[model samples]
Target: MNLLHANDQAGAYPPSYYAATRTPLAEFPALQGQIQADVCIVGGGYTGLSAALHLAEKGYDVVLLEAHKLAFGASGRNGGQVGSGQRQDQDWIEKALGREVAHKLWDLAEESKALVKNLIQNHQIPVTFHPGIAHACWTDVQVRDSHVYAEKLHRDYGYTHLETLDRVAIQNLIGSKVYKGGEIDRDAGHLHPLNYALGLAAAAAKAGTRLHERSEVIRIDHGATPVVHTATGKVVAKQLILACNGYLGNLAPNVAAKVMPINNFILATEPLGDRAKDILSQPIAVADTKFVVNYWRLSEDNRLLFGGGESYGYRFPDIIKTTSKPMLEVYPQLKGTKIDYAWGGTLAITMNRMPCFTRPYPNTLSASGYSGHGVAMATLAGKILAEATAAQSERFDLMASLPQQRFPGGAALRWPLLVLAMTWYGMRDRLGI
Candidate 1:
C-alpha cells in the first residue's frame, strides 16, 4: 500500500491537534489540464511552499502540486522544535568531512533558523514561536556527552546559547526525575507547525505561486524540459523539484532508494491548567536521548503535546497507548491525564541521518531525508533549490556534496533491512548502552 494514502484520506488532512488548531485557509483548485511554468514543484509542504515563495519572489513562474491539502503531512504534524545546528552533531560532521566543510555547514544551519524567524516576522504569521529547547539525558554517559557537546559548540562554533543543567536543574525545569542532566538552547524554539505551514502557503500564493491541491504527481518525464503528470493534468516546466519527503513513493526510484519513510505518533492532553506549569516550569520543549526520542511541549491552551512512538510498517499502532505508555514513564504524574488528541505522520530518513539532496537528472532536483530535523532544514532547502534553479548554486552544491548512503538492499528488501537495524538500536536504548 502507498504510505501517503495509507493513514489519511485523499485530499484530507489528518485529524491532528495541529489541524484542529490551525488557522483556516482557502483550498486551491486541483490541476485539471496542461499547465506550463518556469519551475514545477511537487508536494506543498514546508519545502515546496518555501521554494515556491522564494522562486515567485524572484519572478519565476512556479506551480506547486500537493496530493492532499496544504500542511497535511509531517511538515504540519511534527514536534515544532526549530532545532539548532544540522541533524548530525557538528563533531560528527567535522570527523567525516573535516573542519572547513563542517564550519560551512554550521553557518548554513544558523542561516536556516534565522530564515524561519524572518519569514514569520516578514509574512506576519500568527503562529506562536517561542524560545528554548531542552535536550534531556537519561544515562550518566549521555549526561557527560551532552555537556561535552555543548562545550564544543561554544568553543568550536562560538555558539553560546546553550546552558547545561544538572539533574536538579533539569528536574526543576521539566518536573521529571528521569532526566539525569541536559542543556537548554535559548536560540532554538517551538511553534504551531501547521499554522506556520499555512502562513507560508499564503505568502507563496500572494507572491504568485500557482498552487494545486489534490493534484498528486503520478509520473515525471525528464529531458531538457520535464513534464510532471497527475491523474487529470500535467505541468511542463524547465526545472522540476521533488520535495515529497516521506510521501514520495514510487514516483522517483532514485530518491526512494536513499530516503526511507517511517511513521511517528503524537498525542495531546486536555488543557492541563496549572498542572501544565507543574510539568514544564519553563515554556520550553523537551527532547530526550532515546533511540525513539520523546519530544513534547505545551500548547497555548495549556495542553501537553507529546510525541514518542515509532512504527516501521505502513500502519500506525494504538496511538494513544503506544505514546502514552512512554509519556507516563517520563511524567508518571500525568498517568490519568485525559488524552485529547492523537495522530501519526510519516517522515523520511537517510542512512547517515542527514538530508539527501540529489540531482537525479540533468534538470530535475530532489531534497528529502531530513531525518527528524526537518522544520528548519526543509525550509532552508526550498530556498536553496530556488537559488540553484536561478543559476546560483554554491550553497546547494555544498549540501549535495555531503555523502548520502543508500540502504544496503534494493527497494524491495530495504524495509526488512531497516527493521533489523532499527530493532538492534531500539534494544540498545532499552538496555541503556
Candidate 2:
C-alpha cells in the first residue's frame, strides 16, 4: 500500500533462473548526507548507469541516484531481447522525419547495437550475446511485408542483414506452426538485461561514478547550476540529466506528460531441457508481429523467457496467464509447462514512438521514451547526453528534433487513456484484427 514501494517485485527476483545462474557482486551505497557532483543523474536503469559510466570515463566527477536498486525497474525486469531500430520501422521513421534524418536515425540504431557489443567486450560483462532474432507473423501478407521491409532497408539505406523466412522456413526455425512467417535480423540479438545493468553499474562505480542506492530524488531546482533534492541528502550539480524514463513521475510534469508509462509483463517457464527444441529451431530471441508483441528467448539454463501484453496503469496487470495464452496457441503441447516465475515491469511509449530528448531547464536535461527498445538505445542515449554535456551537441540535437507529445490527460488521467487504447488493442488481439 505504499505510494512508491512496489513490494510485489521485492521477492520478485527470488532465485529465478537469472538470479541463480547469472549476475556479479553488487556494490553501491546509500547516501547519508549532502553531496555534489558534475552531473547528478536520476534513475538507476540502463540510461542513468550508461551515462554515469560514460561521464566517469571522461573523468568528470559524477553521482547517480536510484530510488531502488539498480535495474530494479524496467531495465532489470525486461524480456532480455536487444531489438534493432527505434520503436517504429525505418520506413515509418523516414516518412515521419523525412529521408535524410531518418537515415541518420536508422544508422544510430545499428550503432546502438555495436555500442552494447563494445561495452560488454570492454567491460568483459559475461552476458550471452547470440545471433539472430525472428519476428513471427500469423498471415502470408504479413510475412511478405516483413520480407519487403528487409529488401527496402537494404535497397534504399545500404543496410543489409535482415533475412526473410518463409512459412516453411519459419516452421523449421521456430518449431511452431502458429507463425506463417517473418524476418530474421542476424545483427540484432538478445542478452540478460538485468545482468547487463548490474555489470554496467559495477563498471561505472569502478570508473569513479558515485552510485547512491535508495536515494530517491524528491525535487529539482533548476538554474545555471542544478540541484537534486533527495530524502536524506542533496546533490549540487553543474548540470543534470533525467534518465528515469516512464517512472519520471512528478519530477517534471512536462516529461511525465510526453512519456506515458505502460506495464509490460514477462514469464519464465520451468527449465525446458530436452523440450527446448520444441520451441526455437535455434537458440535465439523470437518476437511475434502482433500489436501486443510476444517476445521470447531462452535463458542460460534453457528456460523459455516469454513476454507480451500491456497494462496501462501502475498495477502490474493480473493477466500473465491471459497474455501468455497465445504462446499455447503457438506451441500447444506445452500446456502445463509450469511458469516458474511471472512478473511485470513498466516501459514508456511516446505518441510518435520517438524518444524525448530535451532540456527542461538551463542545466537540467531529460531523455527517455525509447519505448520497449531501451537496452541498447538507452545506453546510446546516455552517451549522446554525455557528448552534449561535453559540448559536442549534434547527436543530441538530432535526437531532440524528433517530435513527441504528452498524453491528453496528465498522469492521473493518462492511465484511463492508456486503458482505453490498450483495451482496443487487446480486443484486436482477441479478434485477430
Candidate 3:
C-alpha cells in the first residue's frame, strides 16, 4: 500500500504524545521545476538525509526528495531502538564473511553507535536518547546462547561493552520474572525518533542542502552526470543516491526484488509515573531472543513503546491487538497498561538478513536491505555513500562486498516466501521452541 495513505488511512499519527511533544519546524517546498545539484537523493529518511547533510556540509550542492513529509517512513515511526550490530548476530556474520572482515564490521558497528551520539551532539537533536538496551531470553537455552555470544564478542573482537545480567539481574532491571536472563549494553539506546528525523532535516538544510517534500522521483536517467525526473521537473546532478529503501517501490526493480518491504509496528501506552518503575528496575530498550523479536522501550514521559508483530505484505495489520499482544507476553506487569497509540512503518529486509550497498548502475548508487536494523547503520550508509560520491569509495565498497542473496522467491514470490518463513518463526516463538 502507499505507506503514508495507509498510515493516515487508519489515523496513524493521531494526537499521540510524540506528536504533541515534537519539535516545531518549517516545511520545504516540493520539487516543481527543473533544477540542478551536485547530488540528488530520492528519499528523506535517515540514509537520504544523512547523505544530504554530509555532502552539503562538504560544499556539494545537494537536493533530497521525499514523497511525503520528513519522518513519514520507518525513520520516524520505528521502536526508537538505536541498536548496535547488523540484524544478524556476530557469529552469523563471521561465518558468512571471514574473521578479519567480521571484526571490521564489528568495529563499524561500534562506530555506528558512536556516530548517532556524535550527530545528536553536533546537531543538538534532543530525542530523549535512553540509556542502553537489554536482550531478554525466554528460555534457559536462549540465555546460554546469549552468554556464549557475549563471550565470543569479547574474545574474538576485543569488544566488552555489554554486561551479562542473570535472571536475578534481569529481575532487578525489568522487575519481571518472565525472562530467564539477558545482557545489557549501556551503549545501545532508544530515542524520540520523529524528533531525530526532523532535527537531521533541519541540519541538512543548514548545511546548504535543499529538501523538497511530497516530491517523488518518477524516472532516473544515468550517465556521467545522472538526471532525476519528478512529475513537473527534473534534476540534472553529478550523482544519484537511491536511498528510498522500503519506499523504492518501482523506482528500481531489482531493489524491490532483493529487498522486500516488511511492516513492523509500534504502540505507545498512556504515561505511567511510579508504575513505570514496576515494569523495570532500570529503564532501557529491550528485544527478546525470539525469532519474531519483541522490542520495547520507554518514552521520556514514561509511556511504554512496544513493537513486535511483523508483516511481509504492503498493508499494515488491521488489528492493533494483534501487534501489541506480544507486549503482554514479554512483560506481564504491563498487562494493565492502557495502549494509546499504535502505528506501523515499512522496513526492507534482505534474505541474508544483511544490508546491501551496490551500484545498480555506474554513478547510480543503491543502498537498501537494512532488514530491521536501520537506525545507526542507515546513517553510516549515507556517509559511506557520500564518500563514494567524493571518490573515497573504500568503505562503501566494503559494505557492498558483503554477500547478498536475492529474495528466495523472486519479486512476485518473495513476499509469499517471507510470510511463510515468518509464520514458522512466529509459531516457534509462540511455542517457546
- Overall lDDT per candidate, in order of appearance: 0.92, 0.82, 0.82
TM-score per candidate, chains pooled: 0.99, 0.96, 0.95
RMSD of each: 0.8, 1.8, 1.9
- Itemize residue pairs with steric clashes in candidate 1: none
Q: How close is candidate 2 to the true structure, as a TM-score?
A: 0.96
**Tens-place lDDT digits, model 3, residues 275-304:** 888776577888888787788877778888
Give residue 64's lDDT in candidate 2 (0 to 100): 94
* Candidate 2 residue pairs in clash (backbone atoms < 3 Å): none
Which residue window of length 10 is worst by lDDT in model 2?
Answer: 7-16
How well is each residue in 1-433 modelled by candidate 1, as lDDT tens digits? 6987888888887888888888989999999999899999999989999999999999999999999898788999999999999999998999999999999999999999999999999999988789999999999889999999999999999999999999999999999999899899999999999999999999999999999999988888889999999999999999999999999888788888989999899999999998888899999999999988999999989899999965668898889988998899899999888898999999989999989998998698889999999999999999999999999999899999999877888987999998988888888877888
Q: Count backbone overlaps in model 2.
A: 0
Best by TM-score: 1
Off by over 4 Å in 1: none
Q: Which of candidates 1 and 3 reaches a greater lDDT? A: 1
lDDT over C-alpha atoms for residue 344 of model 3: 70
Clashes found in each candidate (C-alpha, N, C closer than 3 A): 0, 0, 2
Give the top-scoring candidate (lDDT).
Answer: 1
